[model samples]
Target: MPYTVTIGREREMAEVRALLERRGDRLISLVGPGGIGKSRLAIEIAHASADLFPDGRYFLPLEGVFEPGLLLPTIAYVLGIRDNGEAALEERIARALAGRRVLLVLDNFEQIVEAAPLLVRLFDVAPEATFLVTSRTVLRIRGERVYEVDALPVPDEAARGGERAMRSAAVALFVDRAQAVKPGFALTDENAAAVADICRALDGMPLAIELAAAKMRVLTPQAIAQRLEQSLPLLTAAARDVPERHRTMRAAIEWSVSLLPDEQRALLEDLGVFARQFSLEAVEALGAGRAWDGQALDGIAALVDGSLVKQTEIGGRPVLSLLAVVREYALGRLREHGEAGRMRAAHAGHYSALVARVAPGLRGAGQGDAVVELGMELPNLRAAVRHLVHIGRLDDAGDFAWRLLVYWWIAGFFGEVRVWMLELLGKDQPITPHTRAVAWFFALWSELWQRPTEEVVAGLGECVRLFGESGDRDAAAMATAARATARLQLPLPDLATAERELAEAVEELHELGNAWAEAITEVSRGRLAWLHGRTDDAQARFDRATEVAEASGDLFTLSVAGNHQARLQLVRGEVDAAEAGCVRTLLVSIRLHFEEGIAYGLEGLCAVAAARGDGERAGMLAAAADAIRQRVGVFDAEAFTVHTPQLDAMREAAPAAVAAGERRGAELTVAEAIAIALPDEERDRIAPALAQW
Candidate 1:
C-alpha cells in the first residue's frame, strides 16, 4: 500500500522535508503516544520519498527483536542479505546502500533502545539510506531529527455540513476509520453529531478512533459515541480537535460500550482483567456457559470482529487482547454494571472446584487424561488463583495453591510457581488435608528451588504431618513421595526426610501390598537419594523400582524409574550408564502405549547422549524425542518446558566442538558438562518461562 499523508502536522512535515532535501538522507524520529499516528506518518513519508530514494523503501518491524545482538541479523533478514556467523553488519549495510537512495522505515524501535547505537552507526556508513523510525518515545540519537505528531485535524461541528462539516481531529479520525469499515460511511444529519461526539469522546486518538469506527459497522454512530462518553478516562480532553461540546475521550468510550448487547458487554468487562492476550475459551468463562456453551460460542465471534477485542495468533489457538485504552474503557463498564466482583467470584469458584476434582484424581490410573485437562485450564487456574488471593477468598485460594502442585511439577514450573504457592498458604486456611498436602509439596519444591534454609525445614515438617494423618493410603503415599522430595532438595544432613518416608512407604506398601504404588514410591525414594549426592543409594533404589514396575506391568512407574535413574547417573558423571538406563526406559514406554512417557525417556536419553559428547547420536535422539512429543498431546507449558532449549542450544553449539574433539582423540565426558553448567540449572530457568507461554 502506498502511504498517505506522512499527514496531520503540516509544520512537522515541512521541517522533515527541509532536512531530507538538505542532508540527502538523514535519520528522522517520529515519536508519539500509542495510537497517535507515528507509524502512519512514517509510512506516509516513506511513500512520498520512494522516488527520491531510487532503491525501494524497506519497512522493518521490530516486535520480536528484543536482544541488541540480533538486530543486525534481523535487518539482514529483511534486506535478504545472507548472515553468516562472521559477517560484518556495517560493511553489509554500506554495500547494500552504496549506489541506492533507500528510505528505511523502522517500526517499534523503542523496544530495542540498546540497539540504537548500532543503528546509528549503520546510518553513518550508509549515507544513501534515509531512516524513518516510529516508536512510542523519541530515540535521542545524535543528529536525529524528531517530529512529534499531534492528533488529527479538528473543525467546528456547527459550521460543518455533516461529518464533512466537522473538520476536527476527532471527526477526521472518525471519518477516516468509519469509511474504511462501512465503505463510504460518512456523518450525515442522522449521525453527524453522533460521529463528532464519538470521535471527540475517544480523545481523537487514532487507535481509539479506529476502534470506535469499527464499532459503527454494527452500531449507529450515535450509540457508539454515547457509549464511549460513560467512561471518564476515555472522555476526550476538551481540545480544539472538534467542537468543545463533543470533547472528552471518556464520553467516546462510554458511547461505544452502550452500543454492545448486554451479554457482549458483560463478556468484555470480565475479560478486561486479563494482563496479556487470552483466547475465546477464556472469555467463554465469563458467562454461565458451564451447561449452556452455545450462547458463549455464538457471541464470541461477533464481539471479536467489532473491534471490542483484538485477536492475536498463539500456537494453534487465536488469543485475544483488548487495546490498553479500550481495556480501561471496559473496566469502567465492569464497575458501572457492578459485575466485576461477581465474575471474579465465579472465576475463583470454577478454578477451585476444578483443581480439587483433578488433584486427587492425578494419583491414580487416569493421570494421563488429568495431565491433558490440567494443561488446558492452566490460564483459568492462574486467573482463579489471582482472584482468590486478591479478592480475599482464602479457602478458594488454598484449594488453588494445593491442587496446582502436581501440575506444577509435571508441567515443570519449579521456580516462581513455588514462590507463588507459598504466598497462597496464608493464615488458617479452611481447606482439607489433601489440599494442604498439595500445597506443602509445591511449597517444599519452591523452597528447595529458591534455596531457603528455613522454608525447606518448614515445608518438610508440614509434609510429614499431612502424610502421617492422611486417611487414604494412596494419597498418603503420594505425600510421602513429596516429603521425600523436599528432603532431597535440602542438604545431605536431611536425608532423614527421604529415608523415613521411604521406610514408611515400604512398610505401608507391604501392608497394603500394591505393586504399582510400591514402584512409584521406590522411584521417588531413588530420586531423593540421587539428588542428595548418594549415587550408590540412588542406583540401588532405581533398580528396585524398575524391577517392581516391570513385575507389576506398571509402564508409568517403569518409565519414571528409567528417566530418574538415567538422570541420577548423568549427575554422577556416568554418561554411558545413564544412556543405558534411559534407553531401557524408552523401550518399556514404547511397549506400554504411553507416548508421553516415550517423549520424556527420549529427551532424557538425548541429554545423556549430548553429555557423552556424541553430537550426531544426540541430535538424532533429540529429533526423535521432538517428533514423538508433537504426535503426543501436549498437556501444558509445564510439560513442554521440561524439553530444555538450553540443552538444544548446547547441542547446536557442540556439533563442531564435538567433531574437533573426536578428531583429536579426546572423548567428551559427562563430568565436563557438569563442570560447565549443571543440567538442573538450565532446566530451572527455562521451565517457568515455557509454562507462562
Candidate 2:
C-alpha cells in the first residue's frame, strides 16, 4: 500500500487531528495568508477527521463567487438538496444535515464575512454538521475553532540531508518541490539554506513556497528564494498540482479581480487612493469615478465577484473592503489611468467639509446618517484622509483633525482610528493657520480621551490661537465653547478664560441672529455655568438654546441643546423629564440614523431607567448607547455608519432592555448624563426644567 504523503506542517497536522478528534464545535476555520497551504491542510485534516465525521464529506470552493450572500445556497447545492433555492432551502438543508455526520469544507471564505453568520446559524441548528473553512482571517462567529496554517518550512542548509527533523512546513515543501524539479535533488546542506531563506522571506506562507518550488527547474534554490523577494507578480503556479486556488497570490487576486466589470474595475482602481479603508458614502462621493446607478449594482457585483472588493458585515449590513495587496494593484492602475493624483485632491476637499459639518452633529442634537449608514462608510472616510495627504490638501486637513475626536471618544474608534490618524497626519507639513488650528484642536480633543489631560490642554491652546487667524468666527466659537466645557469638566484649561471666550461667542451668536450657532454657543455656556456652580443660569441658557434650535428647525442644534437639557434634568433629579428627553432624541436619531444621537439617547435612557430601578431598562439603554460605540466609517463619529458599533450593541442590548431593567452606566450622570444619553425629538418635546424634581 502506498503510504500517504503527509505534506508539510507536522504541528498543524497534529492540531487538525486533535480538533477532528474532539469534534466539539461544528465549525472549524483553516485561516492564514494566501498560498499558506490552507486548502491542502484542510483536505488532509478533513480526510483525517473522516472517522470523527460519520457522515459524507462535501467540499464547496468559493473560488470565483465573492458574494458572501451566496454561501448558503452553495452549501445547499453541495448537499444535493433538490430545489435548494425554491422555498425552504434553509429548512431543507437543516433537516438534511440534522443527523448526518457531514464534513463541509468551505474554502476561501475571508472574502465573504457577511455569509459566515448564515453558516454559523445553520451549524447551530444542525449539530452534526462540521464546517471546515479556509480563509485569510477567522470566520468571526460564535463557537468557530480557528486553525492557522503557517507557511511550509524550509530546513536549515547544514541540517538538510539529516533525518527528517525537516518536519517544518517549509522543509516538507522544499523536499517535495526539489524532488519534482531535478528528480534526484537531495535535501543537501548547500540547498537547504537557500530553500529555507525562500520560505522565510515568503513569510513561510504556503502559496509563496509552492510558487518558489515551481521555479526550481529554471533557477537554483538560492536564486529562486532571492527572486521571490522581488518578483511576486511573475511567479504564478506551484510545482505540485494541488487546487488551482493554491497556485500563487497573484492568481488568487486575479481570479477575484476578473469577476468585476469595466465600471467596477475602474472604481476599484480609483478607490485604492485611500490609504485607509472607506465607507460606501465615500465611494459614492469622492471615491466613485464612474457613476453607478441603482440598476448598475451589477457592475459592483462584478468587482465583488472578482474579490477585488470584499464586503464586511458591519452590524448585519454589507460594507466593502479592499485588502492591502488589492489596494496596491488598484493604486498602480490609478496611476496608469492618470486619475490617481486628481481623486486624492477631491477626496481631501470633500471629507474636510464633511468632517466640519459632521463634528458638531456629534452632540447627537442633529440630523445625520443612520448608525447603519455610518458603519458602511467607515472604510471610505479613512481612505479620504489618505487621499488628502497624498495630494497636498493640508489646510483643510484640519477639519479631520478635530472632527474625528467624536469617533475616538464617544464612538469608540480609538484603536483603529488612532493608528491611522497618527501615521497619516504625522508627515511633515508646513503649518498654515487653518491646518495648525484644526490639528491642535482635534488632536487635543482626541488626546483628552486617549491620553493625558495636560497634552490635550497643550494642543487646545495651539488650536485657540490658530483658529482666530485661519478659521472662521464660527469655528473659533465652537472651539472656545468646547474648551470652556473642558475647563469645567477637567482641571486643565483656565476656567475664567474659557468663560470669557464662550461669553464673547455668545454675544457674536446673538448678533448674527444665527439660531444654530446660538444654540451651540449656549450649549458651551450651559456647560460652563454648570461647571461654575451656576446651575440656574446654565438651565436658562440651555432652555433658550433648545427653543432657538427648535425654531431654527435644524436637527443638529436641536439634538445638541437636547443633550444639555437632559444633562440638566439628571442633575436636578427630574428623572421622568430626563428620560422623556432621551427617548425623544432616540426616536429622531433612529430616523436619521445618527450614531451620536443614538449614543446620547442610550446613555440618557440608561440613566433614567436605572434611577427608576429598572435594571433591564437601564441595561437596554446603556447597551443601546454602547452599540454606537466603536463603530468605523463616516461616523468615525456617526455622520455615517459603515463602521459604527451602535447598531451591534443595540442589537444585543435592545431586545433585553425591551424586556426589563433601566441600566445606563457610569458614563453619564442621572440628568446631565441622561441628556448626554437620550434622543432629539424627546429632548424637544419635554423641557428639562419645570418637569418636576
Candidate 3:
C-alpha cells in the first residue's frame, strides 16, 4: 500500500512537495512522455506531502473514466461523497472543501482534458485545496505549474565496476529490480559494462530498464544488452518520427514483447482491444482463451513476468492492465497482423454478453451495482458500439445499443447514444422487426427533448406499432404509456383521452405481471390527476406506483414516482417532507446514473426551495436541472409550465442572488447538483471517500 520502490525520485519528490506546499501551487501537473514514470513520481510526491495536507490526501485514477461528464463523479467517488438527489455533486465537494486544505491527485488525465474547466472551477470554489495531476501533457489551466518528469540518469559507457557506476540513478534502479529476480545480482567487475550498456540502450527509462532486468533471471547482462541493441531500433523504426524518449520507450516495449513465444505474443497483441483494466474471465470471454488454446493463464503470466502487463486489484478483484505505451505498441502490432477487425468483433461480442448478463439487474435491487459495473465498462462498450456501426453490422449494433437504453438514460449518456442510434437507423442495413422497434423507441426517447411534439408522436407511434407486431405485449404497453405521457404535455392537453390510454396500458402491464411497466403508467396517471387539481387522487396513485416500483426493485420507476410525489407534497404545503422525498429520489437516480431522474428531482427541490422563499437556492436548483436537461436532451414541458411562474416571481425578487445561484448551478455537474439539493439532515447518507479506500 506504500509507494512502489522508487530509487531515483527523491529529488523530484522534494521539488514537487515544495511546489505544492511552499509555493502554493494549487494545480501542479507532472507532465512527461509515456513510460517516463510520471504516475510513479506523482504517487511519490503524494506520499511525501501526506503531512502537509491535514484534511485529506486522495488519489483518483482517471484511466477508467473516458467521458468528461464522469469527471466530477469520479472525483466525488474517490472522495467518498455520496450524492443525495437534492444537491449537485460539485456543490457537495466544494462545500466539503471550503476553507479546507487537502491534496487531491488525479492521474492519467490526458484523455479527459475537456474537463479542465471543471478542475479550474474547483480551484476557484475550493481555494484552499491543492490538486496534483499526472498526465502525458500539462493541463493548460491558468496558474498551473508543470513539472516535467524525465527518464533516470544512466551510467556512461566506459564506466567500470565501482560505487560510481552503481551510483547512476538508472543503473541503481536497474540493479535494484534485477536483484529482485536474480538474488544478489550486482554490477560486478564481469558485467558492469554490459549493465551500463543496457541502461544507456534503454534510454534510462525505468519501465524499460525494469523489463530488461526481468530477463536477467535467464539471460546474462551481456546477452540482454545484445538483444536490445539488435531489436530496439528495428522494432521501433515506425515510431522514429516520434520524440526520442517516446521512441525509446516504445522500442523497449517492442523488444520485451518480442521475447515472448508466438502464442504469448499473439495474446498480448490481441489484449490491446481493452480500453482500460480487464479480468481474466473477460479475456477468455473475449476469445483470447480460444486464441491461446486455453493457455490464457500461462500467456498472461508470461506477459506479467516480462513486465508487459501490470496486475492490480479493483474491488478485491485482480485486474490486468497494460501500460499506455505498451498497449499502443501491441495495438500497432495487432494491426500489422491484420487481426484488428477480428479482434474488435470478438471484443464487441464479449461486451454484448456482459451487457446482456447485467441488463436483468438494471431495474432490480442490484441497480446501483449494475450502474457501477456499466460505468467501469463504458469506454469498451462505446468502442464496441462504434465498431459495429462503422462496419455496418446493423443487427448486432442495434441490439447492443438497444440493450443499453436504461443505462444510457440513467447515466445521462442520451446525447452520445442518440447520435449512434440515429446513425444506425439511417444506415441501409436491414434489421429485425424487434431491433427496429427498439431503435425507434430509443430514437424517440433521446430526441423527445429537442424534437417537436408531432415528430416525437409519430416516432412513438411507429415504436408502438413495431413492438406490437413483434409480439412483445409488455413493451407495447410501455410504449403506449409513453405516448400518453407525451400527449398530456401538448399545448391543448387531452386529459380524457390520455387518462384512458394510461389506464389501458396499466391494465395490460398488470396482466403481463410487469411491475416496472405498471409503475411507469401509475406515475403518468398521477401526473395527469395532479395537473387536473385532483391532489388526493394523485397522491394515492403515486403511493401505489412507489409501492409497485419498490417491490419490483425498479429504481427508475421508484424515482419517477417519487418526483411526482414530491411535487404533490409541495402542493399540499409539506415543505420538509417534499424536500425529503426529492432528496431520496435524487439519491436513487444518482445511484442509477439516471440523469432524467436527477434533473426531475432537482426541479422538485427547486420548487420546494421557492415555496420556502429561498429564492437563491431555488434559482440554483432550477439552473442545475436545466443544465442536466440540456446535456441529456430531455425535458418535461408540463413540469416546466407548472414551476416556471413561481420560480420567475422568486427570481425577480432577488435578480442578483438568483443570477449568481444560477451561474453556480450551471457550472455544476450532475453529481454536484444532486449534492446541492440534499438537505443538511441528509448528509449522513453521502458516503465518505475513506470507505472506498
Best by lDDT: 3
Candidate 2 — which residues are off by over 4 angstroms?
1-31, 35-247, 251-328, 332-366, 370-374, 400-425, 447-458, 492-494, 509-517, 552-579, 585-693
Q: Against the true structure, what is each candidate's TM-score?
A: 0.55, 0.51, 0.73
Off by over 4 Å in 3: 1-3, 10-32, 42-148, 158-162, 183-192, 236-243, 288-291, 422-462, 465-476, 487-498, 559-693
Number of the candidate with higher lDDT, 1 or 3: 3
TM-score of 1: 0.55
Pick by TM-score: which candidate is best?
3
lDDT of 3 at 501: 87
Could you tell me how far off, in angstroms, the CA of residue 40 lies in candidate 2 after the best superposition?
A: 15
lDDT of 3 by residue, 504-554 (tens): 999999999878678878988998998899999999999999999899788
What is the model-wide C-alpha lDDT for candidate 3?
Answer: 0.78
Candidate 1 lDDT, 570-627, residue by residue in tens:
6667878876776666555444335566566666766765665566555554555544
